[model samples]
Target: MLIDALQCGNFDREVFEELKAGGFTCVTPTLGFWEGTLESLDELGRWRDREREYPDLIKIVRKAEDIRAAEREGKVGVLLGYQNTNLLEDRIAYVELFADLGVRVLQLTYNNQNELGGSCYEEHDSGLARFGREVVREMNRTGIVIDCSHVGDKTTLDVIEYSQKPVAITHANADSLFPHKRNKTDPVLKALSQTGGVIGCAAYRNITPADACATVDAWCEMVARTVEIAGIDHVGLGTDYSHKTGPNHLDWMRKGRWTRGVQYGAGSAAVPGKVAKPDWLVNIGALNSVEGGLRRVGFDEGDIAKIMGGNWLRLYEDVFG
Candidate 1:
């Protein structure tokens, strides 16, 4: 039941081939982070064309049951999601509009702060604003899974406490294991787990850094530690496997019309480009390696099933109701 919570890579033939080969049930890819309404609509249109082109290989997941159904059909389920509410343009009604359009997941903020709330990169965590609270309610009402991957710590906590349904940190690691601004702190993990929310443990190079020295074993150990903090049922895969991203994708991701200047987020001026994925996660089949590593770290098949995708399905069933 392999389900990756997030993958912002280019959705090309090779990537979809890898997914089919890897036996992936579903993958939630970012449709928009900072794109405005029109651009977001274009993103959806591009995906619609791509899905039609590969009719046998890809199926857009409009519901949670569609994920399992895609696996049965031997196809990869595509869950359209966004990393920011900027496209909403302060319109509360747009939540239902996008949900009706089959956008199942919506992150509150991106790298920088906006109308919804603050981001992890912001110096001051203003917590959830009044509009942010309203947005949460609308998302809950419309059956969109609220994501807090790039959201500020304060805002995330506020959201977890305030939201009627569970909220997810779609793709990020635990700060206790690999302390980074992008990683979730112990408090955030506790809050998420207690509320039956899941944190998709990222296997991105910068966050996991599963290099020659660190190795896949170390990465799995990190996952084990995260499970200890976030609980086994509250952890899942969010590999952030960026395959075939263009040279300017990072520019648009970090600085999406909000700034004329360059914002080299997570990267420096010296290496202002997309960060490399861990060598072990080069393809979808590498998920087997992750399962093996987790076994070595003492996770049984049932618990691992929860981590891989079962818990996410449960959350979807609860929220996508």
Candidate 2:
């Protein structure tokens, strides 16, 4: 089965190896979120060196061609993305720099207001700021896909209307099914679909409806609801797998210097509590790995193929190419 996974936090060699072993042809692994300029540069440098050292297990992917090539070679194509624009550090030039370094998808904000705009958890969403408009334009010019999963309602709408290219909300749920701040409302879904953007349904336990049991079938049902609202063409899977992040990581995310400093407002309150064990959190393992989950949901091969990675593939090609 095809899987477009997003791995957050520090990269683990063994975990990535397992993804390849388990049949993940392409994955969008995040490298920056709440990272400062210097830190991001250092991380990029390290990633560059690692890619050079381990060319077989992972290779940087920029275009749709790279993904196709990876599939042919039986290797996992690593598409670099960012969960937040912190690395931009109020500088628009960084967008191009990141694009050049193989970062393709960029989420505008995390959980609170930044220079770009308000986050999904923010109490008052004032939409995209002046600087955010410039950032969006620059991203379009650089061929980087914009993501709005964690952005506030107003900001998300503003971005959908403003972007010259189709933008994605890399990971989110339907708020109509589960009334959480992290989930997108019906109007937001319609607007996103209207723009030809894709909404990747996430699989976090907290984000799904509390009434819905925490299982692969339940998650698929939630995704079905999203498809009903946004249409199948605009929906895909983006399992925000924090498979290796423990309680310490959650605490870091909640109280980290990056989040505390920039993400202020009621939006920050929506962030989930830290998981005690990294394994306890959602990962491909939750569905007994990617292929298992698809089968459990009774998804036919074609439906599974589209939701697994085909939709994301089409969306990426349209925006990046």
Candidate 3:
């Protein structure tokens, strides 16, 4: 079974049908990124309507059993998640409220610093703030999976040290391979694995070499090397697939009312705009190509299965049980 640990796709009935037909067992579709309480809750309601509209095609997953059941019934499970803590909005108690609302996965910060903690794009990482530590504790107690993908380096380390439950870098690549700000370093990767956390290697183009065009083989090689460093049990796919989007969406993702100017996320001044995606990894169905690429790269069936989705399943069981 294939599970996408993180996806920010422009979901619709057609997308849901495509995922079901493509044999995806589960996916954590990002519901909030820099969204406030009302906006976030509104998004959740929309997801609920979708489930009602296509009951046979998709269902909201609140537990590991839900994913297994979806797989058994040939339906796709949707795990609602947030890419930032904006919804929490300075209230630690809101953690329980969102957790009760089926928000199982959440990142502490996005690409810039917030009240909770520092971000990867910051000139200096202040590490976890006093409030950030409290947020981590609340998240652990509430069973919300912590994601440090776009968090600053020092903050990421602090979270790995603070959270009692294993956290996840759910949608980032290895810095050793790409050296991008969003990528985690070898030490951070090793430490995350040591804590029994999972790292979902992303297929976002900016996370690969700037000179090289994105390809299935390149993605597979990165995953293989990640397994070699972080172990087979700690690697999975989080593709970070953002399909059916355009420049306006990119502007919102990077600026998000935080700034009036364009931030050009994953883009540069030379080629500033929508970052190109690998054609083979554009959507959930592309997992077939990823599986093929892994097989061609010498991964045994068992290891391939783990990287494909087993590791994420185990993580869900442990964190969201």
Task: Give the per-residue lDDT of model 2 (tens digit) for 73-160.
Answer: 8777888787889989999899998888878888999876899999977779989999999999999999898999889989999999
Q: List the residue pairs that clash in candidate 3.
A: none
Scored by Cα lDDT, where does model 2 land?
A: 0.76
Worst 10 residues of 2 by lDDT: 274-283
User: Residue 81 deviation, candidate 2, in Å?
Assistant: 1.3
lDDT of 1 by residue, 226-253 (tens): 8989898899888777767776887778
Q: Estimate each model's TM-score.
A: 0.96, 0.88, 0.96
Candidate lDDT scores, in order, read 0.86, 0.76, 0.87
Q: On a 0 to 1 TM-score scale, where does candidate 1 land against the true structure? A: 0.96
lDDT of 3 at 225: 90
Q: Any runs in candidate 3 off by more than 4 Å, and if so which? A: 210-214
